[model samples]
Target chain A: MANIAHTVHVGLGDRAYDILIGDRLLDDAGALLAERFPGRRYGIITDDNVAKAQLPRLLASLDAAGLQHSEIVLPAGESTKSWDLLGQAVEGILAARLERGDLIIALGGGVIGDLAGFASAIARRGMGFVQMPTSLLAQVDSSVGGKTGINSPHGKNLIGAFHQPKLVLADLSTLDTLSPRQFASGYAEVVKYGLIDDEAFFFWLEENQAEIFAGGPARGEAIARCCAHKARVVLEDETELGVRALLNLGHTFGHALEKDTGYSDRLLHGEGVAVGMVLAHGFSARQGLAPSQDTGRIVAHLKKAGLPTTLAEVPGTLGSTEALMAAIAQDKKVSRGALTFILTRGIGRAFIEKNVDPKAVSSFLDDMRG
Target chain B: MANIAHTVHVGLGDRAYDILIGDRLLDDAGALLAERFPGRRYGIITDDNVAKAQLPRLLASLDAAGLQHSEIVLPAGESTKSWDLLGQAVEGILAARLERGDLIIALGGGVIGDLAGFASAIARRGMGFVQMPTSLLAQVDSSVGGKTGINSPHGKNLIGAFHQPKLVLADLSTLDTLSPRQFASGYAEVVKYGLIDDEAFFFWLEENQAEIFAGGPARGEAIARCCAHKARVVLEDETELGVRALLNLGHTFGHALEKDTGYSDRLLHGEGVAVGMVLAHGFSARQGLAPSQDTGRIVAHLKKAGLPTTLAEVPGTLGSTEALMAAIAQDKKVSRGALTFILTRGIGRAFIEKNVDPKAVSSFLDDMRG
Candidate 1:
């Protein structure tokens, strides 16, 4: 079995925990969780989509490890992350009689991980949660970070908590079940690490796009490498207080697209982010902070991966340049009237620019259509 | 101005914070918050009751401190802590453009504190929050604990996060505006410290019940002392792992009473705890864990302080012994088949009992009615 490992410091003093990634880490979850949570109660939160395909293996692994557990399956999708649905999850936890020392395992993708982490955070004033990412998106991103929450009408992940998982088991085998679209969406987040801080990695992605997108051992290695980068950055800035904000390179533009599309399957997170990165690069170039060729390279690479690199390529998308800027203003990244945009001086060097003007961003969006 | 002080350690290694209490602490909330969170984006969440009585002075203080802030005044009461209301609070915070460094001040009692703290914990995956507690209950209890959440119809505080505040400013002078009932309710949590592990303090309260209930400098000192004790306990065990369970001494029975009373004004938290403590003492005596005289002292002290010490006195209350046990099972505290009841051997010495049979608890509750 292939082995991969990384660490995420939750910045919570003694309460901080780490995430461990590997091929068969599910077999090790019981031990890791038992170390942090010295109790008997264990509850697993997942969605039907995940439960049907992934829950049995998870249960079998836990059972083989001599750990007892119970499971609850939520309906699949973004709506499951609602405040109403969060209450249902909490009820399920309380109904299971979980205590402060027990653990809740999030056994699905981002939706389950976010909601379960949040439920664990609040269940008994803060208990323990384990993230068992069964999807590429969760494995590379959400599962490692302490950010967990549900969506509000005003925005996605509008209501949530910075609750780190006690342990993260990103079983690479789980990704095998992902559809092409799902796999590609996760690749978008993996590419994010390169865009944010690793120029060499960005170049590597450009060089190895075909191999990684085709899905194999090379893709797994790329996934692990990106997670390692993210984990290191997260440990240094757990609360997104400083360099961690760099991780939001494409998220500001991406969140708007997701919001505009009502977070539908038509515009998967990765697709939105793929297009978002192109826009970010274009905006950075328009501001004279990045080389113009950098924008073309990013778009070309995304297109080669069968991902949408421009807004027009995504069907049923809406928003004028003005609307997108207004949505960006609503982004958590913007402080005061100035937006903190992550721009690349070139492929390898990403920096935060707090002096970026919205009119420049709007103008860039206008140019993207041209 | 009277001086009141209590410190809380968040256990974030060197980043731990203390909650300082004083007569005019709220008068300089903006400055204290700024010291912890050096940003201008702040959103003050208050209720109509607090808005009318406290917002003007708070806003003046923020202005005098040269801080930037916006305010949202929600309707007062438990109803305001619902998901719908919390959704609106999130909208208000987003509307004000709160960022990770920005602070959201929970500027009222528990209801406002819970909702605002939850909103802060979830808004953009967590922002900074300062607890400016204006009520006796919040000052001595909820505000310092980092247990921020809202109540759902399924259960109380089932959805929340243990998001520690950046700072807590408990201005004791605000107690002057509390109704007598409100003041009495706050006193119940203060007595909890003594009942749980401080026999000397329990005896002290027994002797000084009159002075504490009178709402004076002595009362302020008692409140601070309780807060200090609680803070120290929380610092060592923030997540309620072990010793922290003792803090729930009277809460099991108290929660049942509050639920039975529909959490209305008919039974305030402390008053319910007063009755719960009496029942707990009676149950302990029956179990031969404590002397019967200890139960008498608990009831006598509560009576002298004008607090209820019997179930008959709890208005609108319902529950047979079985119902009470069922509610306890529903409590977020249960582990496995064992309930970790904080049973006192006597005043000041309490321990967890895993073998407290629910049948015995039911019988004890039935016997207590006699």
Candidate 2:
């Protein structure tokens, strides 16, 4: 394994697997997979975008190991998470005759990881999958959580399973292909790890933000820390019964904004999360639950990181407050006839608050829209 | 609670649930559901046949109990277990706006239980589900187990999940509407439990066959007994890591026969099982692993139960032995390039044989055809 920079093991009992992070882990991936998962062929699932950018490297690696492999390239976009595309992915694996013990490789960002992981979850009653997360957001967030799913017409990620991956390969080199906005979009989640119960990590990110942006060693360190933090939460609550809900700190509001913009380029998920975290802190401050200055401080850090921190910063006109409230109401995490949101007490301290008043949330959104 | 005769609790730790069996249980289901699942609306999924025969009764009861409910009526048959239908069932549940805490009721036979339960498993990352199994096959088998899914074009039940239900209401009254052939078909599974690990139960069924056919008290007793046996096996191995494989005593051969018959009504699932069980015994006796008379005895009993025990009984021109061998090789339980089957020493002495010879199996099928 060339340049094996970091290995984070998720201790999920029998379902546990390791996440490998390195500059050239992709080069050694075939050797790693051959060594760890002997005797099984591979089904490589990617999207059109990743097919052009990163597919050849992975294909070369697998071929070098003499591993049998099949490829399922879907149209690249958040929309690929629809039922039709899911069927194609599932049928693709079946057509390729991958057995239950075989592994499907999800070689892309969050959308590809979620869709491919979900297809693996149901194909042949369940198959193992490995995550080759190419996006910065995926490396630190979706890839490690075992939360594989697709968005519903009614809401985001409303249909899925909590199927863990057998392994995650975060090839740092893939980030070089990411657009500046896309890279900044992913940085929001790094900020989230620090915001949700890790003040020291937040301070570290603040000090090393420039270095991380410059692709320095701090970037790998920060991604590993984020994964490690998420791994701990997932271990405590794999099904999101409790502490794992903290991982959705900015997601509840973020998802609402995503729905408002129709899950398009106008609002990337991490960008929404960046703005959502700011709103969370702002709303908490308005309710006197968190320090007022904490919200401004979070906004400043996110702005410096090139993440959207305010509703107005989002491109295009957002939906009305009522529509945003309706979107929030439809969130999978929110129970029927009740408002539940991950509210913050201050920096590095987020908690799930059930039975939060809808009127209060609406007014906060109204104020934020200004 | 009227005429409530049997209650089997599957102790899967926190995922534990109850299987309630009783005459007129459908009448009491509304009250039972209301009392147990307060404030949770239900999305009822059933095939057109069951919807006609059982839906009105369930709806009346739910209305009586003031329970909010929605019905999704699919076409009646095995064809309903497809990707399109799975998407329809899942989207139906979502369109009905059944939240994660809400419930979906599978109100038909095995197909409905499997499809609705799978939809619940993935919808909103899993909503709680209840089984209102309306066929003898379902009441005795699928209702008790949490195995849920649809068939892949490659094989039956090749795509799905293991999401347990909140409750299983095996209302005995629903079985009255089943056709005689369908009833006898479901009886094959009842006989299977006896063959797997309960010689005494097998003997008891042999004695009470007339009573069970006449809809006497022995019918409920037999179902409850089968459920309890399955529950014990499930508790020992929920994900079929070990002991649970025993439950598929006749399934390996049965699945192949079903595939050959194109999963058509010409040879029902239980008919295939009946024939498969006879084959298992006959094959074991040929190898001197089981008493030769055991096969004769099982054939006699299944004949008396009106079940098809011989390959010749499966209507239509059969595939050649080689074709049958290929179908058997395609079994999900059989790993790549290896054969696994639930073999029997005698009645109630089935064991998993992981390395069965394909040549031997093919030759045995040739002899059985004669």
Q: Which candidate should be chosen as best, given lDDT against the real structure?
A: 2
Predicted candidate 1 versus true structure: per-residue lDDT over A1-370, tens digit per residue:
3255444344546656665666666666666655656656689999999888888877877776677788888999877888778878887887776766788999988888999998887776677788899888898888887888887666677667777777777877788789988888888888888877787888888878878766656776786787677768877888777888888878888988888887788798888888888888877777787898988887777777778988788777477778777777777777667888887776667788887877777877787766
Model 1, range B1-370, lDDT digits (tens) per residue?
A: 2243544444555536667777777777766655656656779999999998889888988887788889999999877878788888987887777766778889999899999998887788778788889888998888887888877565566667777787778888788899988887888888889988888898787777777666556776787788788777887777666787788888888887877777778888888888888777778888898998888877777776678988888876466767667777777767676766878888887788766788788777787666
RMSD (Cα, Å) for all candidates, in order, is 3.3, 2.1
- Assign candidate 2 its CAPRI class: medium
Can you write out model 2's per-residue Cα lDDT over B97-143, one digit (the tens) per residue? 77888999999999889999999999988889999999999988988
> What interface RMSD does candidate 2 have?
1.3
- TM-scores of the models, in the order given: 0.91, 0.95
